[model samples]
Target: MKPVLIRLLLLLAWAPFYTQAQQRFSFEIEGGHFLKDGKAVPIISGEMHYPRIPHQYWRHRLEMLKAMGLNTVATYVFWNLHETEPGKWDFEGDKDLRRYIETAGELGLMVILRPGPYVCAEWEFGGYPWWLQNIPGMEIRRDNPEFLKCTKRYLDRLYEEVGDLLVTRGGPIIMVQAENEFGSYVAQRNDIPLEEHKRYNAAIRRQLADAGFDAPLFTSDGSWLFEGGTTPGALPTANGESNIENLKRVVDQYHGGKGPYMVAEFYPGWLSHWAEPFPNVSASWVARQTEKYLQNDVSFNFYMVHGGTNFGFTSGANYDKDHGIQPDMTSYDYDAPISEAGWVTPKYDSIRNVIGKYVDYVIPEVPAPNPVIEIPSIRLTGIADVLAFAKRQEPVESPVPLTFEQLRQGYGYVLYTRHFNQPLAGMLEIPGLRDYATVYVNGERVGELNRYYNRYSVFVEIPFDATLDILVENWGRINFGEEIVNNRKGIVGPVTVNGMELSDWFMYRLPMDGAPGPDKTAEVRAGTPEASFLHRKPVLYTGSFNLSETGDTFIDMSAWGKGIVFINGKNIGRYWQAGPQQTLYVPGVWLKKGENRIVIFEQLNDGPKNEISAVKVPILKELKS
Candidate 1:
């Protein structure tokens, strides 16, 4: 047998022995370090979100983290993914938090659970359920009574799922984080009293403790914002902080000058938004920081050692004083050590080398990359126009446009239409446009408005008795900053033309939660003529391709425009021609060895060609400057 093959075989045989079921162990913060069973242990950890990854590949990803010399795996429990609706909880399949933690424990890895009532992981509404907005007098991340009551209920339910997995209960969970980065939020909103922030933080901490999370608790924030975020009894940790001296000083300052310092979220690479260049961090630079952390005995967890994809409409946006609203791209690759497709980059080797020098145990061999395959071009034809379907829905008539939450809708598109009796021509303004919108007058495409660019108004010439339609899409809610609380989708305020408020409006909700199919009641033809399709409205294109063999592949949507893709009824994610990310990562597990269905919801595809290909590689950074 070949030497390489023999080595691999031996390693496989020894892996189980090395990762045998861990005995009951005690983990606590003591004397400036993490003490596991009375021994000081530096926590070499990395962040990986379970919902972002396919459940079938969870073990593979965990093993890859182990191979990188990480002893602990930290994950944020996104509340939105589990309890999507109020009182409607789901913990099975991909949303299984217990399975994820158990898989980590089985791999001889400790877990640090960040069960956030508010996680802010660039997720929709900062990991908040959309139903929260519908609650009467709801104010999140504050000392509001309604918010607290709902938060307690959600946390109580979460504890029921994985509370037994805590280290205190003889499981692998060593630490549980309190509210994520509360200090940053408090700092942003100066109008709120400091006492209210303190009360809210205390309430969240109490809720976690009361919910049976007996594991050592900690709160993470930027080095400068520790004052407002730190819980009284819990250990305080820094985020995005690399300077060992500053980190230690800040933690000490917050925790009464004591020790047990840790950097909860050390960044290897930064998050990328659509239309921007993919952020890249040097492997050597990260290695140097890793070396410093080890040399100083500072425990750290890479913010994302492996950032998976943001499937469906779960991606969030960010708003600032300078930048209005910047929506996150579909790919959450984050340029981490592990790629979104579960392949290790040079950064993985660099960090592993640094870790090997400090760790007592041997680092496992890097796991082999997942297999990939490519498919030939597949032609897709338009089946139904989204606008036509919207017209069929019974409209909600009101004097002004209502928000998505007011309409009992969550994420998707909403169409606001109005018919004018007189010919009014001027600038049409929708100042409360939540995200993105397309304007159409008399079945003709007029212009597009994007919230990312803060373009809310556009010129329009309306003929007498012409019908006007404004199709607004909730790209994503703001996950970070002070604007998060006020994130209401659709038109929240009045629609004006020539400084006059328009009244008597009709609205249709197009959640687009599932792939659009041809309406059976209507004479909707399956492959309609391209010229006959309404260019102003979104179109559903469908096609099927046979695959004798299935493997992981990237659906190349470069030929298409802005829209979402669904494979075999699974909503993979949204794609846009705005560059940065052009391909959607398709896991091999989602494919079969027979014919696989593909559907595309093309929003702005005015081009002639309507086809896509399944490529082996991803196109994450194709920015058009």
Candidate 2:
């Protein structure tokens, strides 16, 4: 064995008592309780993802969590955010995992790190790196050789950064989850065999141990997942907002009638998707549910004390067996105690009061809310032709339509264009359109296709022989269940016209990371979209707004169709006129005192006014689903 490998193994062997002589901060599981340094300490944690929030505001949000009477903060380390591409890893800036954890520790807050190779946090590809899909026959979240090899490397890198930071090594991290909600998915989806599911869970626990994580590793799942998700050594924990009786019963039964009762994910409010209203679990409901758990002396963590934003193209979707694909909204304001803009809601006050009644220590005062500003309508100038941008792209010729992964593309839309020899008019079938697409023939918009409702094929009529362009947008990947195993975006099958499949296509990778500089943008007054540009062709609308003072505000994007927004140079997130989310939250930290640039990549715009404004408050809850 290599010297470094031997040294790491030795360190793993001494993990239990690595820092015992210096600090008495051990967190171990005993009979129905978590013994912190041999004293029973109730863990009241709240889930807050760091990548979703700005790195500058992590401390501010942590303070709010502390004031809410939460002793611990739980967060999932999204693997894809760090390893955007295979063999290359990033742990700096917003992707810095150690800094977030260390900051929580500085504030005297314990940590529960859920570093799942597959987190399923409504994040893109369930936190799996997109490059994983490019690997031949790569079966993820399974006991596959290639997948495990990659997973081991990732965990090893994670341990190198935060291993010594574990509670066993005098750090604030009390516990770490083996994998997130795998049991719930196995039972519900059953994509893999039962024995393989069991073996996969055991293998993951082993890999976590080999990676030098000597702290108590546990499995988190819903009440029904114990049978499939729990292993022999790892403690079993349930997740839910209410049903305290059932939660305790299942967990107790799983551990052979005696074990620590931990609700790893107690949902105060649920996740929202595009076109659906934001989830609205009442503050009273959360207070009552928490009181029940506290009354029973059961420990729990609020799923989202503050859900920031999905930001960029990291949001994931859900593929239901009946309802087809449901793409998640960009704003991850999980309607929790703390709002996305870091404001304390009524739910925060209610949770604090209820938690205070149970804990002996005094709850600190809630942190003051952040300031917000409303700006007048900002007129959009400079219309940059998107087709011109496409002309500069290097096109790949393929026999049939190729998936985004097949072409080595990560996120954003892909343009698939082909010229037909003869005039054609019939039903165009894209059997495997992953998400949404816009069909155009001879530079004219034909129809729209959506994956959410399973609109796979669209009828079209063409006058004569002309070029056909099918621009497909990758909204997001499925984050959960069996479908996620192969959630590759773009068209995976041939484009059939009148039952005849077409061949020889030009594929363009539009990751939309950014665009050409000022030379590409045309300086013009804001009005209806220029008729010269095709309606289906993507347009880059650029504008600037001057601000004397800056604070957190929401940009009203209701006027725009489905597309992405960029403030200055930073990519904010996607915006859809779909009912639920109509605005994008803009943190003041991203803004400056002088002129701030704004760019919108609109896919379709049928609205009258072409203006963007700032609102003081975020439009969180809209019409219900």
- Which of the numbered candidates is closest to the native, going by highest TM-score? 1
Tens-place lDDT per residue, model 1, 378-456, is 7664456667778888999999899999898999889899998999899999889998988999867788898878899
- Candidate lDDT scores, in order, read 0.87, 0.83
| lDDT per residue (tens digit) for residues 402-483 in model 2 | 9999988889888898887777788999978978988877767778888876788888776667788888888888999888
Pairs clashing within candidate 1: 32-260
Q: List the residue pairs that clash in candidate 2.
A: none
Q: Pick by lDDT: which candidate is best?
A: 1
Off by over 4 Å in 1: 1-22, 519-533
| Shift in Å, residue 169, candidate 1 | 0.5
Residue 431, candidate 1: Cα error in Å is 0.7
Assess the local accuracy of residue 406 in candidate 1 as a C-alpha lDDT between 0 and 100: 89
- Per-residue lDDT for 44 in model 2? 93
lDDT of 2 at 264: 88
Task: Go through the candidates in order and give the clash count of each.
Answer: 1, 0
